[model samples]
Target: MSIIAVVTALALSIIPTGDTPTVSVQQGAVQGVQAEGVAAFKGIPYAAPPVGPLRWRPPQPVQPWSETRAADHVGAICIQPPANGDNAVGPGPMSEDCLTLNVFAPEGATEPLPVMFWVHGGGYVNGSGTADLYDGSNLARHGVVVVTINYRLGRHGFFDHPALAAERPAEEPAGNYGVMDMIAALKWVHANIGRFGGDASDVTIFGESAGGVAVSQLMLAPDARGLFAKAIIQSGVPQGATSRLDIATPSGPPLADRGASFAALKGVPADGTAEALRAIPAEAFLDPAPNFGGGDLVIADGRIVPTSIEDGFARGLQAPVPLIIGTNSNEFPWARADTHPMAQALTPEERTALIAAYDDADDFQGRFISDVMFNGPARWLARQHAARGHPVYLYSFDAWPDAMPQPHRGAWHAQERQYVFDTLSTSPWPTTARDEAVAKVASDYWATFARTGVPAAAGQPAWPALAEGHEEALVFHNDGVAVEAVPNAARLDLIAALLDRLKAAGLR
Candidate 1:
């Protein structure tokens, strides 16, 4: 047997399993199984399926069922391309009827506990909450309730056709249907989480990558106000001017134009209605066209994401809540990575000036990408939260798994997940005692943050709130977790200056 299987079996052997646990939600009673001291309720429908006539529309209420429903297994994931090596949580069979969520709570809990609603990341294209990497059992064992949810993905989730817009009610805005599905799940939690021993008023929405972007978006979404009390953004930042709601410059086409282009590719005429596009098989939209390159599908629609996220933060319109945000040490390899707007705009002289401080030319690109895309944005958000007088804790994950053959691999994107969820055994990498130690610390920090606004535990280092001059963050390493000043601040500052120069030149 695999090490993970052996570990899982050993873990399961300790907890006695017997009588199934049942909880009555708003729709009906759900029967779940209890194992390892946690009650797991899976495949609970939070919204009606967006299929057939309801395609591309805002989520509707689920029909109630009188008989007890069995929420023992996960529902179908959203439509997307099959998973590959790049996407560890490979795609499974998908269906339109996939708007479901899972809840994990401490068994025999006398009162409602804090809720951590997780959003998985897949670049707004793929991923499901049911990914094995996101098992909440270990986290739930810490006495907090955990929730994982699935929303629409790719074109099916974020499409905006002019004909469709015209067909919808005047009051309901179009596009960002995936975001709408998240809001629906949150609303359901607010109404029914108490039944699962979760405190609705103490919801903490957390996510990684695209999931992090969703959390940031939720902070700006007016409809999402009051749904969550705390937020954790991992390796995600807000889209700047490129995603403004009202702007439709050549560089950033309006939603209707984007829809028209996509429909044209699908052989639908320019004047074709939304129904024509919806009638096409869902699979037709899953695969990217040969050499197809496009802008973000998760754009700001007037109703869901009212304004540019940057504008919202500048105007202090974001939901004022305690936040913990950070990124990995090495987000991605920067070699020939000319895709970033900053990278594309940088002159040779500007590039030379930016790289002068770094000794290793080989690693410069990776570090630059990490700083510009993930670390810099995270710090900017931390500063914003601090300036607004909200509690904010920043972090940098630098721990490398000993199981990997490469010795110098810094914490790459999504690596912190195994530690944060205390599921190191399930990871493909061969874990060590140091990994377990880090996992305990990271998971405790997360659980503590969910319980209270502060991300502190009895034995771990005391994480301080971000403020002027004291711009410190907790660095997670294999050796230990410690509070230290932000690393590579000078290099990041240089990159930020170049980006400012690009903005002044009107490149964006």
Candidate 2:
């Protein structure tokens, strides 16, 4: 068959047959499938394909369709490096035209339910909403509508070339296209989620790792205001070493310069134009070589992200919504002692004294780095929000499930996701009665928060909001979930001081 005929056939196949569940979104009608008391609408386009001229630009409205479109199969995920043995990318076809989202709602729901929109994390380079780990079925069954999205990844999603910036209209923002895509998705939800048995006005945006960072960024994003009613950030905080939104220096060369540098290594020009860069295949930019000055993921273009997170919080510019933010017990055990910022900033005597205070000499470096990078920032954010009178619930995930091969690493980064999503059966680790019990409690907390802005479950202890004299966190452990005072107060203070010194020295 001709290419046109093939495309037509593929489009036609998406339309659901008689008796399938259907909903009318802003763009068009989508037919979903029902199973196990849940209605799931998959591969629903939220925006126009970001291909050709649309590449690197803010997401545009998806073209409306007339006929009922099939939303049964998963959509293609944004272009990303294939996962190694880790199954990091999960399961999904790869494509540039991947601006789609999935919605899961309880079947036979007559009233609109709270919405939980999730953003998956892959170091800002990989991960997709279609990942098996992000299945929203379990969450939807808890009387909440769940949604997940796929945005651009790697350089295709976040490039900052002078030529591209100059070519665009002066009013348009440059860089951070991935974040722009997310804003567009949220806007779509605000306009259309009601049709899927969801309360558009009661949406809670939650994400892990890079997704959590996006949540933090969205809190301060002017355009994202009113898009989400609440936010949950897990194992990701916008402070310490990863705080800077713009990896490129203001006076430094654009990311294209680094691309040119990489091209030069391959016998190409050292300075390439925007048109020249665009003409290259998308896969060329996917090379894992050190390009674009290394750290140019999210740029603070004064548009999407107006200012530093600290400055925004200090100025009371963050969204006044209830927040849930916390980190795992062991964030990164492979960290090296010499690589930590405090290692270079502090004198030998100070470093010795700090390690002695922690009393875990062998693992002090990893613990200290984890605190400075993740734990400290999380607590600081909670305090900032509480000081501003916004209710903030904090937690620490110390539960090591039987599935963890490296339990000694403690409750490692991103481990809370399974429990929060109640997806332990799909994970590699063996599940115990306690694991299932904890998963239910964790997932209940999330669903409850989405419904009422308070993280509470029926049998779980009362989780207090962080305040001046009431600094506490709901500790999620395998033995039992309980409320406790914030852990490692003095050590966190030391890490905070070290970070201050580093920032003062312009080393951050």
What residue pairs are clashing in model 1? 83-91
lDDT of 2 by residue, 1-508 (tens): 3332233333333333344788777777899888888888999999999888888788999999999999998899888776774434666667899999999877666556789999888877888898767889998888899999999888878775555756889899867888899999999988777777677778899998888888888898899998889999997767411223335454355455544565555444545556665666767766777633213567666768787677777778899999999999888867756686567778787788778767678678667767877899889888888899999999999987766776254788888888888888766677898888888889999999999999889877988988898689999888988888898888888777876877798876
Cα shift from native, residue 95, model 1 (Å): 1.0
- Mind giving the per-residue lDDT tens digits that candidate 1 earns over 1-508? 3332233333332322355888777799888888878888888999998998889999999999999999888788888777764433534667888999999878766556789999988877778887767879899988898999999988778877778867878898677888899999999988887777777788999999888888888999999999999999998766632464334744657766777787888888778977787887887877585211223666677668777666777778889999999999877753343666777678898877777856666566556777787888788877877799899999999997876656337788888888888988767778889899899889999999999889986688899999898788999988998999998888878877887888798985
On a 0 to 100 scale, what is the lDDT of residue 359 in model 1? 60
Q: After superposition, how far is residue 251 of candidate 2 from its true place, in Å?
A: 13
- Residue 174, model 2: Cα distance from true site in angstroms: 1.1
Give all TM-scores, in the order shown.
0.92, 0.91
Best by lDDT: 1
Query: Against the correct fold, how does model 2 do in TM-score?
Result: 0.91
Which whole-number lDDT from 0 to 100 does residue 243 have in model 1? 67
